[model samples]
Every structure is written in structure tokens, then in C-alpha cells.
Target: MKIVNKLKYIGLAMLTLFVSACEEGFDDINTDPNSPVEVPASTLLTNGIFNVGYTYWDRDLNFEFGELMVQHMAQNEYTEEQRYSFATSDFNFRWGNLYSGQNVAAPTGGLYDLSVARALVEENENLSDAQRANQLAVIDIYMSFGFQTITDLWGDVPYSQAFQPGEYPFPAYDAQADIYTGMISTVTNAVNSIDTSVDGFTSGDILFSGDMAAWEAFGNALLIRMGMRVGNSAAVAAGFGGTLPTSDIMLTFDANQDVANPFYQDKVISSRDDFRISAELVAAMNAQSDPRLAMYAMPAPGSTEIVGMPYGLGDGAAFTLKNSTSDIHTNIEDDPTAPAYLFSMAELEFFRAEAIVSGYITGNDATAFAAAIDHSVAQWGASSPGYGASIAYGSSNAEKLNAIALQKWIALYTNGVEAFAEWRRLDHPALTPSANMAPGVTGIPVRMLYPNTEDGTNGDNLAAVGTVDLGTPVGWDN
Candidate 1:
């Protein structure tokens, strides 16, 4: 009887083993919940935010804006004699391409969609107290930087509801004035709130590799830029309610040299064939004896000297043997070696000079202006032999300002939007419309028209903006 009991127990044990084997059929498959959903904040930040910023640099939108602005400022006509096309008549001034109304989405909208700020705000909720604080600080700085760009171009935007499509599907437009004020306040607070105790920095910050110090400097630099933007408007400047600090936000572009510099490498469109330098831009560089000319424009293929034709001239215009083609080219679009600039030491110094001249801060305008020129030239790889000479600063304030504007123009050859904004503010190196410009389109456009897409999707909001003449001066020019 005892033996029979033992045999029955053995049979039961064998059956239990067989059932367990059937349940664990696949040993290699993963079932952990944490492993599948877990993505590092750094990866999210880089792939999402940095990638968008790099896109802007590659598109050459900035350079196109610069050409239009500078040509108008110089009062250079695009007459038929010069074979010029595009912006001959005022009606032809199309700002829509840059803004991407309904036909396409613009960089301004794209930035918000993939902003590290939004991601951090949403995902960091589960982080520890210290981690959460650091993450928020990073978001604050990035958001301010991008929003500032929007306000600088368009006076007003949908900021309150911006990036919150889920919450407010259609946000009312915020006044440009209000947006600027909020930007300053938010950036200042974020810069101050960055926690030094956090263990790891933000991983995908393409501009600043999660470095708190760099982020702080970038924030301050943006502040200085904003301060100068409103410098001409005492009413606007005063409305800041004393929250905007007077301290200058210093920044540098020597990322290759300074580990703290936030600049990073961006992918080039092609080994060759990106952008061509516009005739309008090249002529300006040539006239000023700008040292950065060589770095900006190469001699047309098969020629040693660079020659630029006027804007109004079409393909029919005469081209010297030294000139490449009669067509205008964006530097970044064409040159294989062209570098993309985010912010640079030269731009910072220019802001400082402008700040001093406008009484936003205290310093020698002339000295600061000269330093700005020097830094700009140096950045263009001008120090090498066979390169162009450096710009010389004259003694008087007017001469100094001229030098600053000239160099700034050269530095901005690859940066169209900035060049256009500067031309509106200073009206220097007078540009005229092309004599050959299309009929009825007279002079350079002061501001881009709202994209036509707004007409259909956000008709009410579009109407609220009213019909601003394409020729109407925007922001700083006012």
C-alpha cells in the first residue's frame, strides 16, 4: 500500500512539470513594462528640438530675407538693364514663402510642435524633485529662444494657446507687446531656477549639451537682444515693469574652441550645390572691402577674382569673365564649405554697441562696435593667408556705426531675416529696387504678408490681424 502511494505522488509531480513547460514556451521574449516605455529625456530633447533648429539653418530662409532687406536699404533698383526679377513691384513682395500660411507649416510652428520645453513639461512630472526642477529650467530657456524668433518676425502670435493644441484648439492671438514681456519674465526666472545639484544634464540639447552655465549665458544673450529690440520704444521698454534686468547676456561662437559654447555641427544638404550668394549681397561686400567676402563668396568656376552683377539685371545682363553666373546664389545653398551660424560673439558685441548707443546700457559704443567687427571678421576664417583683410573702424561715432553695419551685413550674408531686420532699423548702405523688377512690384517689402492659409483655417484670427500693407514697416522699424 505504501509503494502504491509513492507511485501516485511521482505521477502527480510529472504532470505538474509538464504544465509549467507549456506555460513558458518562449524564453527569449521580453515582458518588462519599464524597458519598452522608457526613453531618456536627452534623446527626446535632441531628436525633437535640436533637429528642428538645424532645419532652419539649412533652409536658407534667413539669407533670402537678408538679400531683400539689404537691396531695399541700399536703394539699388532691379531694372531691366540689370536683368533683375522677383521683387520689382511692391505687390510681388511675397512674405508668404517664409511664413508658410496654409500651403505649408513654418519653422515658427514647427519649433513649438517638437520643442524640448513641451516634452520636458509633460514627461518630467514623474521625475524626482531635483530632476524636475533642472528639466523645467532647460525647457524655459529653449522656449524663450524660439518664441523670441517668432515675435521678432511677426509682431503678434498665438502664444497663450501655442503648443497646447490639445487644451485650446484655436488660441486667440496674443499682442506682440504682451508676448515680449512674457518672454523676458519667463527667461529670467528660468535662468535663475536652474538646479546645479541635478546629476545628469539634458542629453539632446544640440545648442548647449545640457550645460547649465551655457544655458544661462544663452538666456542672458537673448535678453540683451530683446532689450535692444525695444530700445527705440521708450513706452515699450518702460512697460517691462523693471523685471528685465540690465545685465548683458554675453555669448560666444567659438564652440570648437570653447567647450561652453553651445554651437554644434549640422548636416550639410549636399557635398556640393546648396546655396549661391546673391548679386545684391556680393556687391555690398565688394563695395565695403569687407574682409569676409572671400569666405562668403567664391570666384565663379574657372576664375580667380569674384565679380558681382547688380540685382535688376537678368540673365541678359553682361557678366565679366571673373563673375561665376549672372544668377544670385545663397552662400549656404551653394558653397560646400559654408557654415551655419546660430548666434555668435560678433552679434553679441553688436547688440552691446546698439545697447550703449540707445542708452539701454553703459559702455563705449565705438569700442563695442569695433570689437563686434573684429569678431565678425575673425569668425569668417579671415585669419588665413590669401583670405580678405579685416574691416577698419574710423574714429567718429558715425564712421564707427557705418563700419559696424557693413560688417554686420557681411556676417549676415548667410542670415537673411536678421539682415532684413537690421536694414529696417538702421536704413544704412542705402539699397534701391531692381530696375528690371517685375512691373507694379516697387521697392523691397517692409514685412511679409500673413500666409494665405490663415485665410481659410483661421479666418477670424486672420481678419483680426487686419490687412497690413505688404509695404508696412514691422516691429522695430515702427
Candidate 2:
């Protein structure tokens, strides 16, 4: 698979500019030399990409909420989240960072930075028409990705009215259905606007270094993913019509502490052992004699046995069995340079197979299903000749869809955010709530609750969303 190295030059360039600017303003007494009048688009682009990657891959939101809910990873210390004990405050990080946080133009994280970068690029007269369009299109694709993540978790969220603080201070929450539709429009427009002949971002393009063709492919793939998400036949067709990205869109990292892989930093650098491979995932893999299990989890300490920890248990029981259970494989958990994917070819192939099963597109489900597993296994640095044969594509469409969903679930091991949404849609593997769950947690939660911050700041809009709870289904789940 082709991957962009995410060169560290962006940081160097920013530092060089800062150092150069300091000398110019040093003689002036009135000027505040510390702050720049305007930030460059390249700087904003780099920061926006990093923020998106960091926030999505965050341990609290990704591992604790999404992974545990989908039964991929089990909590070892804080079992409350694993047991469906959720607090509205827990979601504040994702909500605040993704929308309007402290700064309107340059928030600490989320789509605000991307939007700002797009505006800067547009305003820059130095750039040619092709360069400006390509850059803006790439930014649009990224913003759509971020917004989709937001709407997927929460049913109704601030979208259309968001990012305009001066005009609409308290942005109204947009319906999940409308958000999906808006994303489709954004992604479609972005894809159409891409001019592959020209460069998008000549610098600070961490994902694909000025590769407009790659950006176009990424946009198209994103559209397909979104289409499958909302069960929109027209969207599926439109996306399939264009070129689908063959390689994975990844978030790469370096040795820099600020940009290093969060999972590695938390698990190895901090020496925290708060998570383990879940028994549910382990049993499923074990049943199929999955070769990737060796790569997914490490053997129990001292013994070459992969023992998965129980999903959600009391603190005492969990601690007692921690040593006996398997930690995640070092290649994944401890590797500082491991890339987090925005989208993978494996997932795309799975979507293709699913689209066929659902009559969204015309293709052979069996062939696409086999390709999906092959891509997944190969991507994880594993090989199993004839592995596709082990998982049968049944005669009926329903059976084929179930098989695709189950394999796709395994393929999406660490990508808990995407996995959570897929699980809600497919409902395969038949997951149940943990036995030691919080009171009133009768079943698995289909959607995340809004942050308490929303009630405090946007009280009117919050109340207008109507009564909701963890079990309430998002629009796509129907």
C-alpha cells in the first residue's frame, strides 16, 4: 500500500518563520512581537490534520467509549465505561474540539482549523486558480470527515449554523439525516472540484504530499463510505462511478512528543496497563483460527497463550486477572509510528460487498467478500493462503451481509469510532450489554448522549433536541 511519509518539514518551516518574524518586530516598541498578525494556511492545515488524528484516536473517546461499546477492547482499571456507566462530561472533549471550542478560526482541534485554512488559501492571491481549488477541495473533504464523525456518534448536532459565532452564537442542532445529506453534498462537491493535474498543498500535506489525484480518490472513497453509512442508493452509485482509492488514507506520526501515536504514548511511555484484548473478540477470532490474532494480541506473560480478559468486570476481578490476560500486540500498542487510518482499502472492499448485497450496486458479493478479507489480513502484516475460504459467503443475501459485517468488524480492530457506527448499522455478531452494567442500562447504547456543556451554553438548542438517552437510535441505525 502506498502511504505518505508525513514529512516533519512543516514544523521546521513554522519554526523558521517564527524566528525570522521575531527579528523584524524586535525594534518596534508598540507591536506585540510574540503574536503573529495572521497565521499561514500551511500552518493551519498541519495543525488541523494533527488535531483530527489526535482527537479521533483519543483513548477516552476511541478506546473507552467506542472500543468497549463494540466489545473490541476491555477496560482493566476504569470499568465504569465498559459497563455502560457514562457521564455527559466524558463527551465534552470530542464535542468541543470538533465544533467551536475556544477560538472560532483556530480551535484547539476539529473542523474549525480546517475551515480557517481553506479561507486563508482562498484569500492568498499568490496561488494559481488550480492550486486554490485543489487546496480548498481537500479541506472540504477533511471537514466532511470530521462532521461525519460528530453526527455518527450524536444523533443531532450543530452543523449548518456552526462556526459562525458572530451571527449564530448558539447554533441549532441539525438532524442526523440532514447532516448525512450535507456531508454527501460536501464530499461530492469536493470530489468534483479536484484538479488532479495541479498540487493541493505543496507543503504541510501530511496525508498525501500535494497529490491531488490521491486527494480526489480519498474524497470518492469517503463518499462511498458515507453512502453505505446512510443506506443511500444514489450516493453509493455516484461514489462507485468515480475512482475509489486503492491505498489507505492514514495519519502518520514521528518521534515528536506532540505528534506521536497517542496509544503508544499512553501504553508504553506512561507505563499504563488499563486495557486488554476482549474475550468476545478473542473467541470469535479463535473460532475461525484467525492468523491475525497473533498480531492483534500478545501472549500471556511467560506463556505463549493468548488469553483475553473479560469484557466488563468489577475492579477487583479485573485486576486479579490482568496478568493472566493478553495485552495488545506490541506492533500495534507500543509502536510510536503506527499509522491511524482515515479509510482503508479493506473497509472499501467490505463496503463494496455490502452494497452489492443491499442492491446498491452490481457486483459479485463472494468475490468482493474474499478481496475484503485478503486486504484486511495483508494490511495487518499477516498472510493466510486460502483464508477467505474459511469464512463462507452463504447462498442468501442476508447470510452474505452477516458474514461481511463480522469480518469487517475484525478488520476494524483499533478503529473503534468507525467500528461503533458499523456495529449499530449491521447488528451482526449479536453483542449484548455487560452483565455488570450500570443501573438503567438495559441494552447496548446506540448513540452517545450530548455533553453537559451543551445544556449550559446552548440550553435552548439542547432542549429542542427532544428527550434522548443512550439506547435511542441514531438516524442511520433505523
Candidate 3:
């Protein structure tokens, strides 16, 4: 979206006035009665939406998701031989946080929640008709994308009644199936309604800069990704008649160079603080002689090889570095300014390859699959030495699929959520979990548990949805 020219004046001036007034107390207060209580739409969108998006995209949550999936994919094994413990629950809280009810704190006010989406939607209505429609379209895409991600991880979620705390003190949970269907439809409609002619969106659009075309592409790409979720289910597959054909769905990858890429700027609080390359992920890349390896990870101390540290290890063990190959020494590597990816042309190619392999689309599967790998490598900024020219695509169909998935895993270093989700679907580049890991986690967790708050506050609705253990596999897990 176009940068708001007035943001500096508003943000800085407001902060200055608020601080100055607070020091004066009630007697010196000169609050403008007619001034807007709420911040500008641009500031709100940037802080509420883009900021959160970048944080989530670059951090442990995304990495954990990818690590779990990669372990299940069999590309690597969780090695206690190494002392890397970031991915382990013992060192990082995310493992347990995700499974337990604790992580629910995010939905209450975090970016992943509906509050920002609602704010954008509500504000768009006050704009001119054309602007309103365009903004609404963008909001729909984001809202649907967010909700779909929530349902994917936690089967039953507060959807219809969610974000309306006053109206529904305890919102009912919607089934995963219903949520997916609704998300697809909502995103589709939004993509179709976008007005490409709009000059610019209100500043704060961190993903695409309010470029309607990019948003349109993103919506369609998301639809294709969602459609593949149910690809293995006969009933669901038949429902779509093997192919979910719609003008909105971009079945082929289009490399629009102008497409906005969300990355960390030279700011301390940006994406850099939240993420790191897991030893498990780095090792997988090294094994394949993957070109993206160096870009994604640094050489571990005392070794040139990129080895992965095992998950579920103790923090005390991290410094030992027995089997560890590399460590991210700076936040610059992990932060959003470090090129945190939301979506990319590479991902689009892989999706199409999957579609072709599954018979959902007509194409030369091998060609599409190989192209996917090539695109993914390029997307990862693999121009450095030691990076391989291309990922090896084995002769067999399974091998070809593995190659596609492996490259996807590499491409997903920044976008771990998608990588994790895809690994579950493809189940390739085999990974094995740590033997010392927790019980009932014999393999990777299939889905995350609903936040415990839902059970207490929205007990009846949660009860209706029934409880599924965090270990339960979903539609994507074969």
C-alpha cells in the first residue's frame, strides 16, 4: 500500500503530546475534544497486521512447525548428539506452549487473531465506495487466511462468533471442515472483487503495499493450498471433481517481480528477534548439498558442515555443541528484515506440481515438479558458493515428489508454517523424532491443542466440538 505521508506527523506528534500532557496532570491537560481517539487506519494496520505478520512469519513458532514436519518427513533425525535445543521444548517454551492451553493468549490480542482484521474491515466501510470495496476485498483475503490457519492447527475454533466478544461472551466453535469451506469461499469472493485500478491502499499494508493484484494473487494461491488439504479424502476430492477450477485460482506460478516481499528493515524490534534456523532444518539442507543451506544457516562452531542440533535437549547442553553444525549468531538472520517470506512464486510452482502429481491438473508432472525445485532454490537467494546448482530430482515418482518437498522445505525457512503444513501433506525427505522426547509424541504432533481458555470460558461450545489430543493427525497427514 502507498506509504501514508502523514503518519510521521500523526505518530510522532501524538506520542509527544501524550507524554507532555501526562507530565502536566489534570490541571494542565488540554485534550482536544474533537480529536480522534483511535489512531489512523495506516498506523493501526501496520502495527496490528503487518507487524504481527512479520513476527509470526520469522520466529520459533514457524520454525517449530517446520521442524516438526521435517522430522516427520524423515529428512533428518532429532540428534541428542548435538546440543542445539532451540527446537526442543526443554530450551524453548513453544513446544509445550503450542500443545498446552497457554498459547491461547495470542488470539486474545495478537496479530493472528481477528481484532486487526475487524479493525481494517470496520474502517474500510467509512471510505469512499471504491476504496471501501477494495479495502473490504483485502480484508476478506487476510481474514480468511488467518482463520484458515487457526482451524488447520486447531480443528474446532471460534469462527462465526469469534471477534464479537460483546455479542457472544462465549463464542461457539466451528468444525474444521466448515471453517475450511468458508475460508475458501471468502477468499475467492474477495479476489474476484478486487479493483486493480485503485491508486494505493492506506499505508500499513506490509505484505503487498495495498497492491490489489498481489492481494488477488495471494488469495488465489491460498485457495489452491487449501484445496490440496483435502486432496487425499475421496469424498472431498469428489466434491471438487478432482479439479477446483476457478478464474481466481492461479494454478501456475507467475513471477511478478513487483510483488511486495515482507522483510526486516534495520529496526531492532523487527522480525530478527523472533526466529532462528534449527539444527534439524540446517542438517537436512546440508545432507542434500542444497544451495539454500548457507543462506538459511551459518556453519556450526568447530565444523564447516551444517549439522542440526537435536530437539528436546537442555539449555545447559547448548554450549557443548557436540554434534551441532551451525548457530545463528545474530538476530539479523532471524528477524523479519532478514526477508521473512509470506508467500512466493516458488510456493505456487510446488502447489501446481502437487496438483499435477495428484491428477488434479493436466501437465507433465516431471517438468512441473522439476521447475518447482528450481524456482524454490532461486527464491531462497541461493547465489553463494557451496550452494548446489539444483536439488536432485530422483527418477521415481516418489523421489520426484520428495525432491519437490525437500526444496519446499528449504524455501520455507522464512515461511515455516507453510513448510510444516506441506511436509505433513507430502511426507517426504524422511525425518525421525528424538528418542528422548516426550511420551505420546512417538512421531511429530499432527495438530495443536485448542487453548485451555476456550474450555473454561466457552466450555459448552468446546465440549460440543469435542477434545482432540494435540497428537491427533489431520487431513494433511497421510
Candidate 4:
């Protein structure tokens, strides 16, 4: 997969124009009828896709928040988030970007851009019915992915009325159950709506290059993912009934400063080593002799051993352990053009295995389970001979599901948000709460708290949603 360099140019140009148009004298300067003030759907698509990919790789949200919470990575310096102590302000970026957007003069958010694109697609006069339908479906599919991330993070969130500023300024937060149902329906409909005969977006499509077939596969995979997440095996079966794409849905980055992989820039370019592999994860992999460990981390400096830092340690202790602990592998942190995955074929296989065990799909659970591991190892280009034979798929459904969940956790490396969500849903390979926890923090957080700004801006709606706390589980988690 290659990063579209044109996306960077288009995004920057649109932002400049957007900011200039907000000035008082700008509108008067542009009197030409042919000059369009409104940003086109293609430009919006580029902005939205880039933001979504960027957010997933963001240090604050995905690393410090999701990865730390799930014990995949640990803090080596300030340990507030690692110890489950964080201000509501920590979530403002993610929450705001998903619902609204940043930059008052030139806002660009995933949901916001996709919504604008949908409207523009509907209004386009040159597009044929099939082209328009496929385009709209593609937008909806991306929107569904964004919504799923939002609802999974918090128990309830603004969904039904979101993005309709004039209609519902303070959109009521929809319950997680209702949101999941809606998302599943949206993905299903989007998959059905796609017309393979025509292209979705001939330009500005960063994921699949306007391939409707890829879009359809992505939608089905998303549907299955959501269904399996909420314990709806029937939806999983429905999704598995269709053809799955051979490739993962991802966004690739380039070495350019404007579009470099965030993790790479943070660790290598900036020379910041604020995080280390967690001892918990290291111990888990060591127990199974997981071959991916070599691919996931580097040996501690001056030693051949790959040591992990103790999770949730105090600032002094964490700093002390930092040098002895391994950082992320050079292949990852040292490479600026790595790909960030939205959904992977490995994850799809895991879902299929789960659906099979649930008796909702016709397939051998063990075969799918083995294939899942093989896909994961192949995807990472790791050597793991006799790996599948080493692990056992137990007889009972509980044991089988446990095996799947544990392996899925390992396979979901670097994708902290999705990994955290699955850990909450499965509760397998039970993780211990940090012994050096923050004040008033007794257990691991099940969900993220709403951003503090929401209270000031949408206080009434915020209050109506009930208590917002780290301890409260999301709908599917319970």
C-alpha cells in the first residue's frame, strides 16, 4: 500500500482557502460566479480519511490512553494515564474530532467530512444513479467505522442527531445498544448499496483507490466485526456469508513530515522514548514463546534481552526501568512509512473462528483459529514454525472463545483502540490492576470518560446520559 501524496497537497490547499474565506474582506475579494466557496466532496474525503488514520496513530489517544489501559505499552516517564489517572480534558481531541472537528476556521473530522461528502454526492448532477449510490455508500461505510469507535469508547454518545447542527445543536447521546444496532444496519445497507460496476471516488480515496469491490468487502468486514463485538453471532454469519477481501483496509504513511507515521515521528524523529513495552505483555508472550515478540520490540540497549518495563510504575521507578526496558522494534519506530490498519484480514479470520464456535457459521473453528494465527504471523512477516501446533483449541465453547480472544489480543498489536475494546468485551487472559494506581483508582478502566468541555457546551444533554466515569462499562462490555 502506498500513501497518496496528492492527499497532502489537496488537504493543505483546502485549509488555506477555508481559513482565508473566514476573513471579513475575503468574501468581497471573491466575486466570480465560477469560483466555488464550498469545499468539494473529494477534498473533504481526503481530509476525513487522513484525520481518521492520524487519530488512530496519535500518541495521546491510542498510545497513552488505549495502549496503556490495555497494558500493551507502559509509560516510562509521567505515569498518570498508566496509573489510570487522567483528566477529562485528555479525551477532548478524540471526542471533539469525532463529533465536530478541530480548527474553528478550517474544521476537518471523519464523521463531519463524510457527512458533507454524502450531501454533496446526493446533490451532484453529473453522476449516474449507480455512481451516486456507490459514492454515498462509501461515505456511509466510513461514517459507520467512526461511529463504532465512538460508541465503543464511551457507553453512550451523540449519534442519531449528530452532524445536524441546525436541527439538533445539543444532540442527545444515544445509548450504546441502540448505536450498535444502528451501525450494524448502516454497514449492512452500505454493503448492499454498493454498485461494483462503477467507481466510488475516482480521486481523493486514500483507502482503496475508489474500488467498489474493496469498499463492499470493508463494509461486510465492519458488519461482522460489530456483530461479533456485540455478541450477535447471526450478524457475523450474515457478514461471513459474503466474500471477504484479501487485503486489509489501511492508510499508509510516507516519510514526509506532513504525512509521516505518527508513532515513527514520535519515537525516532523527535528522539522521544517516553514509552516501553509492558512487562505484562512480555510475560504473556514469553509464556507462549510467541515469535512476534521479536517483531514487536527491540532488545534493551547494550543487551541482547528484550525486557519490558513494569506497568504503571511511579515516575521515578518508571524512569529507572526505561533504559533496561525495550522500546518498540526498529522496523516499526524507525520506519516513517508504515501502514496503519483500520481492519485486517487477521482480525476477519478471528471473527470467523468465533462465529464458527458460536454455531452461527459453517466452518471448522480450529481451522479458522489456526488460519488466524497464520495470517497474523504472515502479516507481520514473522517466523513461527510449529506455532499453531503448540497451542490447543479446547473442546468447550468457553475454552475455544478464550483461546481466540487471547490470540486476537496478540494479533491486534499497535492497534490499541480495537485491542482495548476486545479486552473489555472478552475479559480473557485477565489483567491485573496496577499496584501503583492513582488516587481513588481501584481497578482498570472499562471505558473512557466524556470530555470536560462537553459539560460546559452541552451540559443538559451530558447530564441526561447519567454518570460518566472510568469504572462504568460500555453496553457490550457488560
Question: Total clashing residue pairs per candidate?
Answer: 52, 0, 26, 0
Determine which window of 10 residues in candidate 3 has minimal summed lDDT.
Answer: 17-26
Highest-TM-score candidate: 4
Residue range 1-478, candidate 1, lDDT tens digits:
0001112122111111000000111111111232222335454444334323433343323433445455511112323322223232321212222221111211121233223234544455567766666666666666566565555665666665443334444545667666767776766666566665563254556555666666666666666666666653332233222233222222212222111111122212222221234566667667766666676655766766655544444433433321354223233333433444556777877776766665666668777776776676776667533222334667666776666676676666555666766766667767766565555556766665554544544568747866675466665568
Tens-digit lDDT string for candidate 4 (1-478): 3333333333323221110010111111122233332767887787677766676666756787788888989889988888888778888766765554452212245456656666677779999999988887887778778777778887787776665545465667778888887777777777887889887889888788998999888888987999988988767877888757797777888777556787887877778888888988999889888888999899999998789988878899999888889998888788888888899888988888888888878888888888888888878889877576577789999999999999998888888889999998889769888888878777999888888888887888889998757888888887
lDDT of each: 0.48, 0.76, 0.49, 0.76
In order of TM-score, best first, we have 4, 2, 3, 1
Query: Which stretches of model 4 miss by more than 4 angstroms?
Result: 1-37, 101-108
Model 3, total clashes: 26
Q: Which sections of candidate 3 miss by over 4 Å?
A: 1-40, 58-60, 64-128, 232-283, 311-319, 322-324, 329-336, 384-390, 394-397, 475-478
lDDT of 2 by residue, 1-478 (tens): 1212234223212221000000111111121235232766776677677666667776756887888889999988768888888888877655765553221212143455565566577778999998888888888787777778888898788776665444466767878888788788878877888888888888877778878888888888888989998888888888889977878788886665445677887787778888999999999999989989999999999899899998888788898989889998899777788888889988999999999888889988788899889888888989897787678789898888889989999999999899999998899879867889899887888888888877888889889989888989988897
Tens digit per residue, CA lDDT, model 3, 112-224: 22243334445454577667666756656665555555556656666655543344546666666666666666665666667778743666566667777777667666677
TM-score of each: 0.70, 0.90, 0.70, 0.91
| C-alpha-based local distance difference test score of model 3 | 0.49
In model 4, pairs of residues that clash are none
lDDT of 4: 0.76
Which wins on lDDT, candidate 1 or candidate 2? Answer: 2
